[model samples]
Target: MKTICGLDCCGACDRKEACGGCLKTNGRPFGGTCVAAEWMKKGGKDEFLRLKNNLIDEINSLGIENLQIADLNLLNGFYVNLEFTLPSGQSVKFLEDKNIYWGNQVEIPESDRCYGLVADDSFLLVCEYGCGGADPQIVMFQRRQAGTEIKKQNLV
Candidate 1:
């Protein structure tokens, strides 16, 4: 079976043996009290599975007929520049980047802190910071179409 890296999917943490994260002690990535895990477990297995499917659906709905992967730079993080057309006939240029952290939770740098963007499909993009007992802030952004008079939806 094929597997995705720790990027979009959960993988066995190399630091799990010595790390103090719940996943490290539990031997499973999803079953933990971590914020992300807790969010996923809120409604049990079905909800978690639904959330995963929703993420996949959002990616597919982007209709990425073509995709390009850019060079990975440690300082700049891993980036991918996407040029794709939306179903509404609008063209979109999206840049996505991923940074890895070995701590118990993910943190977004102060410079990167901003309101999150949520897709029409309910998938959210936000900066997650802190670990263990730290409370993460949920930043929200407004997404809008160019030249359209419609008000943008406040993403949460």
Candidate 2:
């Protein structure tokens, strides 16, 4: 029942339906739900393993170092947050988007952050980043079901 977020920390709260840690008046990101848990229930355990491996591979491919696993309480499934330092000496943050559609990207201008929630039929990963200015970049690595990978190419 370990759950985590891509922000290199445990989910806001231990509850699967709600998180108390990162409390934002606005509902959860994605689609007002927990995307990672949904995938776990749909694909089962084997798919989860594959999803994890794929994520690791993706991170390595990015040439990112200084990776850290965030704390995720296991309420429904294993949710985790991975924090890493990009080669460019920038920071990245990743999180789980709970929207029904896997392939969606959202940008927050106030924070200068871009988010990519990609999913295939079996897996879903939330790829987020902060660009421009002298702010450190952030990326999130969240695990979802297999074959549910979504790709968000552009962030407006």
**Candidate No. with top TM-score:** 2
User: 47-145 in candidate 2: lDDT tens per residue?
Assistant: 554554565455344443332222222221213333446888766534343332224345655656655444434444555555522333345444543
Steric clash count of candidate 1:
2
lDDT of 1 by residue, 1-156 (tens): 111122322334443333344444332232222322332334444454454444434433443232111211111112112233456867654332222211111223454322222222222333232333133343322343222222233323
Question: What is candidate 2's TM-score against the reference?
Answer: 0.33
| lDDT of candidate 2 at residue 111, scale 0 to 100 | 52
Give the poorly placed runs of model 1, Cα more than 4 Å off: 1-11, 23-36, 67-156
- Assess the local accuracy of residue 92 in candidate 2 as a C-alpha lDDT between 0 and 100: 53
TM-scores for every predicted model: 0.31, 0.33
Global lDDT of each candidate = 0.30, 0.40
